[model samples]
Target: MTFSRVNAARGLTLAALLLAASGCGAKNTPADASRAEPDPLAKLQPAQDMAAYRAMSDLLYKLDQEAIQRELTETGQEKSTKPAKDKLFGFDATRAVHDRDFIASGEGKALADSLLTYQTPSGGWSKRTNMSTPRKPGQQFGTEKDYVPTFDNYATTTQFWVMANACNAHQDSRYCDSASRALSLILLAQYPNGGWPQSFPLRGKYHDDITFNDDAIANLLKVVGAAAEGDERLAFLSDGLKAQAKHSLVRALDMLVATQVEVDGEPTIWGAQHDDETLEPTSARAFEPVALATSESADLVLFLMTLKNPPENIRKAIDSANRWFEKHQIHGLRYRRGDELPALIPDDDADPLWARFYDIESDRPVFGDRDGQVYFELEKISAERRAGYGWYTERPYKALKEYRKWQQ
Candidate 1:
């Protein structure tokens, strides 16, 4: 039977016991955790577009989350204790934490407990907090007075999925309750214009922008879209939540359509960030310019494609953006990093890669560095930044694939 309902009390108890028996209980004190050193991976910070790791940001997380689910069905075991070669987002990356098939196992219950420990009053999680790491045996995770919930760096997005998975692994009210709180947090964070800020309860600066950079808006839509669609993963959500999700998604869709950057009054793609009110392209980090963001807009297009029956305007939006991606695609270039510098080298056999940004006016590919200088030539940026950032990605191909399938 599908673990759709949130009635996992029996499962919860059983799982709780199993967790304790398995030495995964919440007994370790905060002092025990305090002594533990941070994982070395947590220290690896990118110089630019830290949240905009192209192949990652959201795609890799989405894929790897599914990959773990697929593996559980085949192997019927918990994830490997060994490290995953695959990249991760936020602090979970440091742990290579796989969202395993834990419904029947108590693993899901224990995991949900971990999530609950970290959840804030806003009903969401803060970014870069470890999701895979269990708190020391007895200490709560989010008791640190400063744990503010956010949508940045896969914050609320990751929580929703983890809770949803826990609910599915076994009916757990806490899991569903946490997820519902997250849903409300997400819903409340929306601007009237259908855009989402990077953080909720409103922090200043880029936090308030209509963010597509790092796929924050896209991830919000993914969960809200799932609930609106009455997806089984979120079957426990009430009809009211579903309706709220639907209405929110409908409004957000309009926001997306309205936010597309236009040239000559013809819709093109979108920018990484947009003004919350005016909806015009806005600058995010200095390296991220107010331009047609091929990456973010592409993900947004893919999100639109996921809708079952899109309105004409949405289909048109997808079509227009597809045209932009196809037009701006870079050929004969491959990015390869080595111990030596000059990471991106030309390869005659290289497949196509899309530039991260485009000049909204000139319609030419543009690159930027930490010093806030935008360059036309790929080689102009310093080597440290050139290697640290994702100036290119394979995301556009998904839009093309989805578009072709939609046509069919």
Candidate 2:
């Protein structure tokens, strides 16, 4: 049934029950929840622009959802036999839809039903079907032709945020339970040094191949924020999220502090750190830091401010990060030390974060390398390859504009 239909029916059923209750168990009716209202989220219910927001959110949500469904179908039928190569992704689409209340009318739950079909025994989702099954242990590789699971930590993070948010809207415990398990996996996956590895098997096995940082931690933090404060898992929940933000922030800050190239006596963050092993900043590639550009740092700063008595250290760290951001933003974009010269990476290869940060103000979609090429490899690929690809095909300007609307 549609969301409105289900909700309306549920509402009427409970009302009829309350009317019939007379003197018995009236406390158990929907009125119980209603009396306990004053919902914290009432203000967030976009009454004024809600219709517009819902329409826009739904369009993107449906498009992304179709891709996710396609991936899930390709994973093979688990009830029969496992496909040789089975990978699943595209959860972000569900998440965006859920958060925007596209599911409020119930259509979103239908999409979510497909996702639940792929859940693993451990409560966490495997990137591909037949993943939980015993298999040879190593970095499994597969081509586009094969359904190899992509083992990125960000995928798990996205699942938590998506599922957790869904649970809130549906008032269903299953989504919350799934979210908790995914969150736990992330906590367990943290390295002794406090950073999360980029890929899965987040243990001693593939220590050599892990580097991409900020995005995963940012995603994790957003999911953790979705949890209710008084929930039973609050302690574990808060600790894990705070630890992620704290440690990861420190590591990121250290990198920024250590390697921010000095141009005209000002320190600036670079695009990607260059280290073959562990991908630390042994060298720097001059793609600009993008998130800080569109006031992303400001958003995080605001989120941090919402904490009741935020730790002094956390506040201090945010302050430092903010200062760096304020100093870095110029002509409405964050660039490497000497941005007057071309970026260190090719234009197409430019960091997406930069587009995100600036909301596509100046240099965006593709930041030009000294040689005038874009940093994104996808941009370099033939137009045929990138044509229908969701992310690659999304120009930075358009992506940022859509995101800005959502934030509103």
Candidate 3:
């Protein structure tokens, strides 16, 4: 099907399914009619805009429900599968292709070949898929419901790295061809302003936003930067591709500097995501609010510091972000992870910690819950979030340590 046609069909299907499930247009009994509950799908009215619709937590829950219902309808039983022996295809798998001998080995060849089968027409791999198993005919490229080719969770960039290394070791034209296609996706997905969306083909909502979450754009920059600098892993790239990579690298760096949040005309850190057009800090998941994100900002600063002889603007951006880190560092408290619940314990000699999110104007730490409520204290959130999320981090210390060396 044509892309546009497919999207339109998906919109119709989802809306029909969700509306029916939500009791929209359904006959109401006298008792039901008297009880007056708000429509559950009210937040999902803009279903035509896939990005916006997908960003709503309610819609996501509904999508999962639909998937389960479809599975039960088709098979009349719950689908069961064996647990994986080791980690499936993910960032770790991408990092595992480092040894040249391994890339040339028989096992490595098999893994690389499997990756080729999984590559979508968009020239990117999907996240959390099992590339160990070859793609079945007519199987969807993405394993996740409603997810297409994305850069999120170190997807395409990592696949490209594997392909490039495999090409280098095997001297295989097919590997080189695959690497080139992946490079094209990276180039095509970049916004005119030099930022990258979490997903390509413009999946709507925060996925359409220029994302720094989980080092999304940073990973893209690394791939292109290597290609531009003639890194041996990507040595198969043509002169034309290299030139394009160089241009992409320049634009991406410019976007990074431009997106740094400024409060009262003084530069600070950045949010995990930014609007593609406005470049303003934006929210992503329900628990992720529009605020200065310390972990992502720290990773960004570390990447920037790697550049040799940066311009004045880049230097200034780094310095200001470092100051913000220093000023906001939490003292006399250490975050302790417990079996039941995590807690912030008071300890005078505790290493400085940084909150995951901070108020843009006040610089005070903030917390978010699944209900979309913002809290000033970590204890105020749900137990699941407190136990599952990294509410406090020492990541800024690494950046600060690197910055000191960079200054010297």
Candidate 4:
């Protein structure tokens, strides 16, 4: 059912308010508000975590800018790591672009410029390169996967909307031309049943399965809404995208609801990578559901509440999931996502095995595939995974422990 514009606007407002509460330093109630002193966060302006995020954004911006200027030589390469025409700028240079505070900074403009250059003749970018490079800090990661080529219609279509929006937000029109092309691509990619696949193969190879990838199409539809308001370039399909995103999200949400599992009273969401043929839910592959109260399940519920006009069912799910999280929160420098489990087989005198997933009602831990298999009985894993219980586990586990306290 389609929501009226007035109702949708109200829903969006409520969602924005919920999102604000989710950020950090939200007070519990107005009655408690009188006695409670304002948190430091409540008084301060929002700022990006400059040290880590800046360098990465800067590097990404510079690379994009160079690509836009046509300064690099293009060899029509098929691989992710194809060398640019110019001498490669060091990774440090790219990182420097992100050093600025705002996404609207000069570096951002440069990125918009670069993205503009890559739009294909068909109004979308083919897989010239992959954005993420899993490299050590200071190293430029390279991609070996060519999963998102222009020839792949769904991928290209989504990229077109993303690039267009990212560029438009920075007031750069260079990306406008590409955005128009992408609108054309979207019209071509839509399915008869109002679903979208990740790729569009021209040579009679049909690949259609709805998953998280479809979320990209949903987001693109919002962009198309903006395009239709006479922003030109890609204005043609703005109405189409808005309609499709609403239809697609509803379809996707139904599929997700059908896949949810309940353990005791708590609910868990499924991750992708289930058994395709049998449609069986697999272990935590990609955002797979876990029992309620565990950090995994609770966090999912918390995130879902931020959606505009969240359904009554979704609200109930979030409430149950969060109640479990609130009760089981570990308090201290050392904490686990949930209660720890005794190792089925001992590893050392002090080291006891633990499950990553926890049961809120039973007060037990849910082990993974490798939770008790004998190969690890004599073998040793890194301390990072065994953090909180181990003698020395500091980085993220410690940070997580601290954050949990704030949630309480």
Candidate whose TM-score is highest: 3
Query: TM-score of each candidate?
Result: 0.73, 0.43, 0.77, 0.43
Error of 2 at 321 (Å): 2.9
What TM-score, to 2 decimals, does candidate 2 have? Answer: 0.43
lDDT agreement of model 4 with the native: 0.36
Question: Of the candidates numbered 1 and 3, which has the greater TM-score value?
Answer: 3
Model 3 stretches with alpha carbons more than 4 Å out: 1-95, 346-350
Provide the overall lDDT of each model, using Cα atoms, as 2-decimal numbers: 0.65, 0.36, 0.73, 0.36
Q: What's the number of clashes in each of the models?
A: 8, 23, 2, 21
lDDT tens readout by residue for model 2, 1-408: 134654445444433432332222122121111212221111111111223222322332232233233333444422223333444453335444446476443655554444444432122344443322222211122212111211243455545555655666676655555555555444434333333334433222222122333344345445444342333323334354445434544443343333333334543322222232333332112233221222323344444444445555555544554444543332322333231332223344433333322212233344323332344433563443233222221122333343344334
Superposed by TM-score, candidate 4 places the C-alpha of residue 333 at a distance from the truth, in angstroms, of 5.0
Question: What tens-digit string does per-residue lDDT give for candidate 1 at 389-408?
Answer: 77778688678777888778
Stretches of candidate 1 exceeding 4 Å from the true structure: 1-100, 133-147
**Alpha-carbon shift of residue 84 in model 2 (angstroms):** 14
- lDDT by residue for model 3 over 183-259, one digit each (tens)? 87687677767888898756678888999988888788788877877787787777777888888888888998899
Best of the candidates, lDDT: 3
Q: Write the per-residue lDDT of candidate 4 for residues 6-27, one digit (tens) a residue.
A: 5445444533432342332132
Screening candidate 1 with a backbone cut-off below 3 angstroms (N, C-alpha, C), the clashing residue pairs are 8-171, 26-137, 26-138, 27-137, 27-138, 28-137, 28-138, 103-169
